[model samples]
Target chain A: MTLTATSPAPAPAPAGPAPDLAALAARHGLVESGARPCLPEYTRRLWGRRHFVTAFATARLTAQYSRARLGQLWQVMTPLLNATVYYFVFGVLLRTKEGVRDFVPFLVTGVFVWTFTSSTVLAGTRALTGNLGLVRALHFPRAALPVAYAVQQLQQLLFSMAALTVILCCCGQFPRPSWLLALPALGLQATFNTGLALVMARLASRTPDIAQLMPFALRTWMYVSGVMWSVSHAVRGDKMPHLVAVALEWNPAALYIDLTRFALIDSFAAGQLPPYAWAGAAGWALLAGVGGFVFFWQAEETYGRG
Target chain B: MADAYDARTPTVIADDVHITYRVHSGRTAREVHAVKGVTFVAHKGEAIGLIGSNGSGKSTLLKAVAGLIRPARGRVYTRGQPSLLGVNAALMNDLTGERNVVLGGLAMGMTRRQVRERYQRIVDFSGIDDKGDFSTLPMRTYSSGMAARLRFSIAAARSHDVLMIDEALATGDAAFQRRSKARIAELRATAGTVFLVSHHHRTVTETCDRALWLEAGTLRMDGPAADVVAAYEAHAKAKK
Candidate 1:
């Protein structure tokens, strides 16, 4: 295979002078960037690639329903189907809806809100592992994957939220001034979901087994989160242990769900709301949002490596 | 090409770089040291061929240079963001080839307008759109070779400061290979450095000006393309 040894391997041409790499980099606007980008820079890069995030999310969402018989209808139908099943199992069979006014709407609201968190968290686990090929082949912010998944779920949730509004009206809960509050409630929930998704993506990308165990974990969380039944009613008059009851009441998921129910369900009263529901929502969002971002960013460079 | 080898024009430098990967054998975990202390300087307009046996860390070295992996020790410095040629690796098989082109372009840091303007050229380069609506079909429907060609085409659309190609040309036909060779030459002419990893001695000798021969995670030879390739072919024949 040798080319007739026509020219001896031209020895490396003499290196004229040692170049100052730092100065050279400065002159060329280059940096040693193989390491994890700093947080501020990463955020800036992420912002710069915001279009990619939305584009990716839209692509995934469209493809997700591409093969389904019901097509995009399944996005709204999946949650409504779950709401029905939960209404049967918990509301009718267990009579878990006892003492809860506008029980159907309450159950629907909880189901929709909880789905936002559970779906995002589960999808986040697969964000990196599912796109390992992309991660390996492309150079971009790894956070884009999880964030895109979260956005996809948010898109899906927006569809389900429309369904929730119809369910609310049919159940005699008309649009009230308080109904306006679901906006901030969803905003907080979305922020919280994004953070949790980031954290879960990092963990699941490393272990992978976390994906298998996530469903069971999320199921338990759903029970405690009052997805189908009121946490307040479940623990009312010391029916459950004091500490467990308090934990359920203050659970971030439960708090967000309760806030939505208070806003949308006519029977749900603001007085029954947790004293610091708004504070709790903001705190959880900040804790998960800021903390998860840092947590995920700290190991940014480690992602997609074998 | 006057100052192509000038030290001041160093386009890529790997400083005693090492890469180790954690692998599991059954239930036992172990670390495989893929690249051990490889140090080299590539100048502007250089076409470097990385030749090695299977698992000799040719791909790993390229990946480390592309910033896909942080080496266990030492560091790699590149002139700019290096685009590894398997951009199709990032393509979603479920999506149509057309969508993959757009997504792949965005991922490669091309603006929307750039991708839009070059869409026809990319499709022409890949030859997938010659038949009506073929690019609209899902990538999973395409053969592996077609997919590789498409990826190469998309990546080659943009001139990169540092480009790493891993066995991309091995899948294409003679005509495609010739076109790719010309593309690499053109890239180097534009002062872009390219690292080609391939086991095809003929391909390496023809496409690259210099060659690095790796054996079992170490650089066994580094010299002109023909010299290192001849030594490598002889070593393989002897082993056989």
Candidate 2:
């Protein structure tokens, strides 16, 4: 086992004239390391990891508030506090709630639903960057990170929903058959948010500065999504340009918020939901869900690499 | 060295792999050619040690083999997904060690039931509870060595086709080191290829049958472990 020490060690001899190593590996059923699987295969792998996704999400959510004294209570309390601030600013100070009915219920529902999208998008921006250790150490679908973050936000939204329900009941908006409509509405929003999360995860993996910029972008998006004001009421008549009104109505964030609002609030549900509301919700979910997935998958092999 | 692994069946092949990292410093980007056209083939049941001085690209080459970093010029092929266990592969620090075990096991593609079955063994292997119930405490509360032990334990609980370890064994105490070496041997007995990168030349010679020595992002020596370690040590002494 001994060899004479040399300053520049000689290269090892080729193993039988190289012998087409790639072909040999292929013949032995080897696959290229880090190669992106085809879409169906990638989907299958991601589906296989569904349990991991949920567990990872739950772990993160539980650990999020571990340092705070109030702990998990903050999950519901955070959104309730946000609604309180928004209610004061818009309902009392600016009087923007003048035209809207059941202002508290509307505001609370909008806050809960909008928080789902905003937090999911924000989490997506950090998904790959934040979990680089996991990504580099383990071999799994990269989509799992963003998908798990979306699930985390959905869980947080559920906590906020419990609070939202109590607030709705206090405001005299008791449950009705229409409350079931919120289920499909939320299901669509969750899918849409998951897709958007996938897109953001891929983007932020490369340009991590996007994470620094995302909060401002999401805040601006929140304002336009009608979290604090009703898009339909603001767009009524010539108060805004027709195209601007149409764009606001069709905005994915506003569309989800509006769908949930229409389903949960008596005032909003009493008025006929525009015929296109469900169509728009389904459209955005499919577009973002499929498009964002494909977008994220295109860069699968490149996630942890520099 | 095991009858189960036929020496002819190669488990990993690196065909002229080159990896370059563009490190961003302020507004400018600089490209560091980390692994330059490195080529090698590892067979099943073999434990290979990667030996190099600091910044010699041993870790980079290991990462390339693990599929975490793509080669810029060539390709790496493996019989199955290669898992890399590194010092930096920290699990969630804020979560309890128990939760990390579960999460790490799942991340390695273990079924929930498998994780449940192996949970106690994994904790006992880590020795995190030898003093107290440290497994229930947050990982941040454990010492760095304890965390490394736990990480290694979780990764070792499942057999992998190819496992690349980077400086993980250097942190553990002697008893843990002995246990890990035994586990690595057991892994080889199951026909898995193992790649270890360590600064301790003796650990390499004792644990691996073969060695790959990289110098300045290029492979310098590839041979029997004792020979490569001897050559590398003599080279280091000569330079001093």
Best by TM-score: 2
The chain B TM-scores of all candidates, as shown, are 0.90, 0.91
Candidate 2 shows a clash count of 0
Expressed as tens digits, the lDDT of each residue in B19-134 for candidate 2 is 89878787787889988778788887789999989999988788778888888877898988887764235368889999999988888888999999999999999999999999
Q: Put down candidate 1 lDDT per residue, A1-306, tens digits, no spaces.
A: 433332213244224222443344445455564788889999998987777888788878877877777888987788888889989998999998788888899888998899999999999999998988888778888999999999999999999998888888788888879889999998999999999999999999878889999999999999779887777767779678888877988899999999998888877888777789999999999999999899999998888775
Q: Which stretches of candidate 1 lie over 4 Å from their true place?
A: A1-30, A238-242, B1-8, B143-146, B169-179
Backbone clash numbers for all candidates listed: 0, 0
For candidate 1 chain B, which ten residues in a row score worst on lDDT?
B1-10
Model 2, runs deviating above 4 Å: A1-19, A270-272, B1-7, B86-90
Chain A TM-score of candidate 1 vs. true chain A: 0.90
User: Which clashing pairs does model 2 show?
Assistant: none
For all predicted structures, in order, the TM-scores are: 0.91, 0.93
Highest DockQ scorer = 2
The per-model lDDT (C-alpha) reads 0.82, 0.85
